[model samples]
Target chain A: MFTQFFYTLKAYKVPVSLTEWLAMLQAMEKGFAGNNLLSFYYLARSLLVKSENFYDQYDLAFREFFTGLEVPEELFDELLKWLSEETLKRHRDSVDLSSLPQHDWETLKKMFEDKLKEQKERHNGGANWIGTGGTSPYGHSGVHPGGIRVGGESNNLSAVKIATARKFRQYRKDVTLDVRQMKVAMKKLRHLRRSGNLLELDIDESIDQTCRNAGEIELVYHPERKNDVKMLLLMDAGGSMLPYAQMVNRLFSAANSVNHFKKFRYYYFHNCIYDHLNAGMEYGERVSTAQLLKNLNSSYKVVIVGDASMAPYELFMENGIIDYYDRNETAGIVWLERIANHFRNVVWLNPNPPRYWQHPTVSAIANLFPMYQLSLEGLESAMVELTRKAH
Target chain B: MQNFEQYCGTGDYIASRALQNDVNVAIALGRPLLIKGEPGTGKTLLASSISEGLETDLLVWTIKSTTKAQDGLYIYDTVQRLNDARFGDHDISDIKHYIKHGKLGQAFTSPKRVVLLIDEIDKADIEFPNDLLTELDEMKFYIPETAETVSARHRPVIIITSNAEKELPDAFLRRCVFHYIQFPDAAFMNDIVKVHFPNLEEKIMKEAVEAFFSLRELDNLRKKPSTSELIDWIKVLVASGTRPKDIGRELPFLGALLKNEQDYHQVANGETDTRSIRRPSFLR
Candidate 1:
């Protein structure tokens, strides 16, 4: 009776040995797990499986093997929520909706207005009303040819627009990096143009020089090739960037770990690159834009990490900054333009997905400096672009 | 095991029906209960609570990012053994003297079944969970130094907690009984507060919970006050002899609630300077 269960676990790569199977069988004989299916499920898993990560996989296998066993509603609810968002997003991208009749800008606007007035109470899985699931022309977690998302999380990219006030966590600065991988990728940013003092021996060059000197064995010391790349990383550490904290931290640590730079300095900004830059949270020295322009020369490769998602007013309108006293002389764009003029190469690493680059605030920043995703691949390409002229 | 009923029944730790059910399922299966939740959601407390309830000795293993799987097993002090063999007055060739059992090892070796708390499993590297796969499943591990196998006399009731800082691998997740502790709702939170502050006035408790929920609803604020923060904030409120209605005037003391500088500025500045705060009516 338990053979099929034992085989099922093994098939799922659970690494259940014969001895363990026998032990479980003996335990079954002793009536430890009892007759309860849920109890049996736990007993089998505890006896055969280890590690919490595998619990999810074992659950799926158990559900399938048992067939019609009632799982706790909470688990299903969480799984469905996670899957709907992810699966909907993935399928939405691949699923071609171009063939469907496209609604013009005016029609979309009118339809959204109509749905807002009609949507009185909460609705789900229907043809209309802002709710989750179904072929509604509005809401999220549902399939539709094209619609708008309101009050729910985004998954179905078919939505013409989204209006959400989701809060994100602050980008942590303490995330450690895989130094080896970071070193390999960061080597691309090396500007080996100049030679410095002979600090370390170059075995290959030394050997060649000795052979050229007719095996005289006298050492020939040459100036060491240095990584002359200078980088100025200005990170947006507040508000919108809160969600991408982990990814941003990885990028920050990656940049910090790489030793292939002549000068590497970093600063913290809120949303947009404004006149004042914060050095630290407490007793943070507010460096003026003029001081920054004067101190860092054009050789510095400026890389910025931010979601760049903020109200347009914060970027364009005067005195529109969210935090601190908004006594800036000009708009944020003006300060950004000045920084761009001073720096030869700049790349903005947005922690938010590339699909969100179309957001007005993000697009506005993208127009100023070349923007890239904050993934390892994204960082690699950005480095390549930064080193295009130098290499 | 019979005492588990009474232990859970009278325990200080308020077990939601869902939580209790999950624990029961884990016990039935003899599997480790993998409890993942946000920080301050009582992931650590559950272990001690269960141990207290079960009348079992609780063995805790707090894991760090650098913590290896081998650290949970018996650690062989080969260097010490070598030194002892070379320089000691007596022949100390027995490897048992050099072998120190870790929390997991000690739990497995205990005469009575123990409650093992593996706190912050996600803090360790990816390989740590996978390394424990065989040992945890079989309830046994080999000591190469002693050339002997150490098997559990009684299977421990293990409670593993993760903050979900890093994603656990699929294989590692499949083996355990999983439970996710959600942030307690308003009514549930009231009960949770009463657990900590029993003698506090009902009106003050109600007002404090209301204020906490309102602060949580502020989407702009970073690091909103969690359950622990709310309790701490209420503790200060009751201790200072400040009435619930007078909380509006005591807005200056918001350090307990808001941790972020930006959040502090948003709440504080919004209260004092209305011109600077471009917020909704409720926030103003």
Candidate 2:
């Protein structure tokens, strides 16, 4: 009945619900797929998989279930070679276990350095010398236990190889946020208020007025309700935050695209906010912290994104900022406290997970502001916290 | 069950076999066919193509960010009624006088079956698709003001397209047939171009397609040229009387292919290594 295929898709975390499963069955019953497996593959894929993000996982599941169905004849030679090599590796593993010389950590490090100095040309498939595919402990893909895997393919089953390759790791929702999802999350920060001109007619009120007037007709008008929420996003850029640049760019683009905000502004800072914040990510124009505090009132909801990973002295001590030319009389923590005190609703979004927030600077900043992880749930909760009535 | 006509590719539009199959399946099942793809892959054009192939009238409802679900079914023009009452120029007693039919209402009350194309449903609010779920599934909607229920005379073929501005609700997606139109490969692109320009020279076509694909292969292009762009570039080449051999050495009218300033400069500066363009086998 191919029920295992449904379970296989679910096992691969494809989010295939029974509704889609039944739809695919109905499509098949309607003779859309006919009897060919190729047509059936396309039919099932178009029905069961909703998003292209899950297409790769569905492909993996399909290959896992329908093994050797459409594999080319040319691959049989490679398959035979791989099978023989696997058997040879198994045979070598049983005999070579006793031959591997035991060396302690320091001795191994010293021996690797000595081998690097002694060896000159590239070495492959030998018992001694640092090279690839041999009994050597330092080289790659050989029979030695705890051998270092260098720049060579792993000799394993094709399924394991494909799974470990993880070609679609970036498409996984848990790994990063796309612009659309972030825009949806940002949309929850709306606070509607009737502030515009009274252009729309109040029909019910006009009807009530006319009914009360007995014979005369009257008209009523009301202002349109518009989103009045103002937001200020301060993001950490460059330095230790370089690894998360793409993710932060997605967030930035999402925030930029949500045009419903009354006023949306963003600025960039390094590890911590000090005397000034950069107007752009390239640090072209500078906006002083004092100037920012004077211009923007406490009504603006502030969301600061950063890793909060830095030297303790850089945050706690004066004249300890990492930028050599820019000196500050006030410490980074003091500036953070000033902003936190000025803003009624403020939240810190750490790209690093909560487990890594044990650093001294992170805890110090977390105590100053309610810190939340930069994720979908975290963003929703942070927006909830920002919209809550402040005493 | 009603007899539904099959949709083959029209003379203008060249659809892939899988797309043609999905379209036929959707028509037979009487479900909305949701098409998603990159910007210029002709997700919107497929609806018109289906209409043309099936020989039915096409009703397009272009959605915007401010579009509401109720606007598609019926709009109770209360303001017009109030104005009529104030001016004493028109009838205001009957509430149905001001009730106007939207695109969906028009499709439902049409004399003949039509193709309902909800273009770019994701441009509207995230809940927009979910709001139309009942109307789309049951092919009927109720108007509380007029105390009337409007159902389809004959079930209209529904087609929806999305740029993926927002993730559609699962309930809305569940009721529809989904298909993702992949960007065509080189051979497929050649067929598509020939459909547009049947009289194009063989040598010019070969050189143009080769240049267009290699330009797309360059890294860090913010917006890669698509099918529409390629067709425009080919039109420009044919009109300008540019030589086929000159296309490999100096790509004239590069603006039609690359729209981004960064992408334009990248190609113009010869940063990409020009792969050797071989003559087509037929030419030799």
Candidate 3:
């Protein structure tokens, strides 16, 4: 009988507390058996169930839970009368609270959009027409992104608008590039072109680096435009960095704009990319940065971008990007020069406030490489640093 | 509770009010209440506890790999008496007395409510549950040897626990009330821990609880940490005067909650943390 009651309460969304049951039994004056069947129901409700919809549910539950069993009506009335509001509310809410959880955008879209889409897709044979939204297949409208937009295309528009855009385009066919948008990070790569970064060649840097030498920095130079081109990008994935995730993401888009990533191929490092660059969650195989570098000569270009700031040793210590297992990854400078020696082309874009770039570690790290650091604000001014070289 | 509680911690078993109510209905109606749960969740404890609380004698008839019904009730006394009086008075009547007071006989004769804990009824081969139906339904067990069926004036409380290793025959299930036991949630575990270990630092206690539950939810968790293991975890913490830094070292020993070795290794290697996934506002 009680087994039935358990499923009974569960279905009704009434939580039957083990703690409450003990209390209820203690409060009861009679054995559960001798009590009228009605009283038993009331007693169980008072003890185990407290929800708003108990009466109807009890009617349903008692029929199922108490089926094939005969009990008196008096006990049932007592069960109904003594129910507390919480018990009733719980029962009523439990019916509705059938656990429809608040959904994230992905989850919400996943749940409804698929069903809606399937409805549309299955409506396949119907005539593709409006008012047909109620009857037709591909949905009434707005199903496709700007597909035959009611207001027309936002970018690729009608001839009238295209004409207008073409006219406007003539004057401002004027365009600019921001060096800071260079986010074409070799995300989750195992090894860079094995030798060095190829994003750009700082002929000025090679000269400066060679300044350390009497005449030449012994430039291990080979600038095979095919082989020497390289890039390294590190993106902060978690923590407070979440807000700028979209911005950081967009920076990557611009980075691709500067150079189509597929054309140049590259390496990835994180705040502490260290050796984990190989085993990053995103990596399937080691990207062989060294092998990538051997294929190129000094003509390769290299660029780096990041906010470049962190908690103490977040760049170097345990719990750093190096991953806890690898505390001894070569310094970012060591990795930088390995690539710099291969390709003279390199630029460091800092998303950090320009004011912060003067921070000691920032300077120490920036000075380590022959890098031209540009803040995101001076994006236009930073262009042509690359295009100028090619020209 | 029957000694079964020693095997199952409170966390693995929640005394179901519904089950208890059903047991009462069984007692009032002279029927049996059968329970089903995962093997480790302490179905045995429920039968045992109900028996104890009601001041009834708990006769645990644990179903075994090859158990037969006759094995539980009335083992013939002929062998014992014949051996003791070997080369002497071996009366046939004495054989009848020997055929008495096995699981069924003892249950029949006990003046108080005899709680027949048919533990793991699902374990025995098919014929056993089938055999018991007559005894369970009629409150009388037949022994062809005695030629007179044994009956109980006051129906002994019958409680059966099944692990559901295999599907049960419907004809057998229809006779008893059934309740299922699922693993308890954290709030339930917290109550259990409070009951199990009333004195411990609030912080370590809560952290220990969180750590164990997280260990269940994350870390490639395979099996949930049951109540008994939770207590053992708390016991380990209390003995060790837990330090925040030490959580890493000590958490792997809690391998009982995680069935897979990889989960243990991950926790050991600092890949898993009991910490919540909060969006910290600094990575940008």
Rank all candidate structures by their DockQ, best first, as comma-separated numbers: 2, 1, 3
Q: What is the TM-score of chain B alone in each candidate?
A: 0.91, 0.94, 0.80
- Which window of ten consecutive residues has the lowest lDDT sum in model 2 chain B? B275-284
lDDT of 1 at A336: 83
lDDT of 2 by residue, A1-391 (tens): 5677899999888878898899887776656664334556667776787777676787788767643222234633433342233222323323334347766456766776677567765566666665555666554455554333343343422333444355555555565576677887777788888888997678889889988987377788999789998999999995899988977988898888888899999999989899999999986899999999999999999999999989998899998788888898999999999999998899999988999999999999999999998987688688889887789
Question: For model 2, what is the alpha-carbon lDDT of residue A293?
Answer: 93
lDDT tens readout by residue for model 1, A353-385: 689888898898899988887765677678888
- Grade the docking of candidate 1: incorrect
RMSD of 2: 13.6
DockQ of each: 0.05, 0.27, 0.01
B37-110, model 2: which lDDT tens digit per residue? Answer: 88889999999998999899999999997799999999998767766877898978899888999999999999
Badly placed stretches (over 4 Å) of model 2 are: A69-188, A197-199, A205-225, A243-258, A280-291, A325-331, A337-391, B1-5, B79-97, B265-284
Predicted candidate 3 versus true structure: per-residue lDDT over B23-111, tens digit per residue? 56555545566666444556677766666576567898888856778777667654455344544565544446567566766887777
* Order of quality (TM-score): 2, 1, 3
Can you write out model 3's per-residue Cα lDDT over A1-391, one digit (the tens) per residue? 1444566656855545555455445424334422223335534543443322233444455555432212235533332222211111111111211122333335533433344434422222122322111112112221211111122121212222322232222111112122222331222111223334444444566556555765433333433232223444444443444555555555555555544243454444555334434424244555555665676566544555555665546644444443544454455445545655655545566655567777655675666543343433233334334323532
**What tens digits encode model 1's per-residue C-alpha lDDT throughout B1-284?**
33222234224678765466567556655667888766788889898888887788899999996688888988886546544654666558667888999988998899998899999997776568999998888889998777888899998888899875555665666557677675788999989899888898998888778777777777656476888888888888888888777664345368888888988877876653222233476355
Candidate 3 versus the native: TM-score?
0.41
Q: Which ranges in model 1 have alpha carbons more than 4 Å from their true place?
A: A1-391, B1-10, B272-284
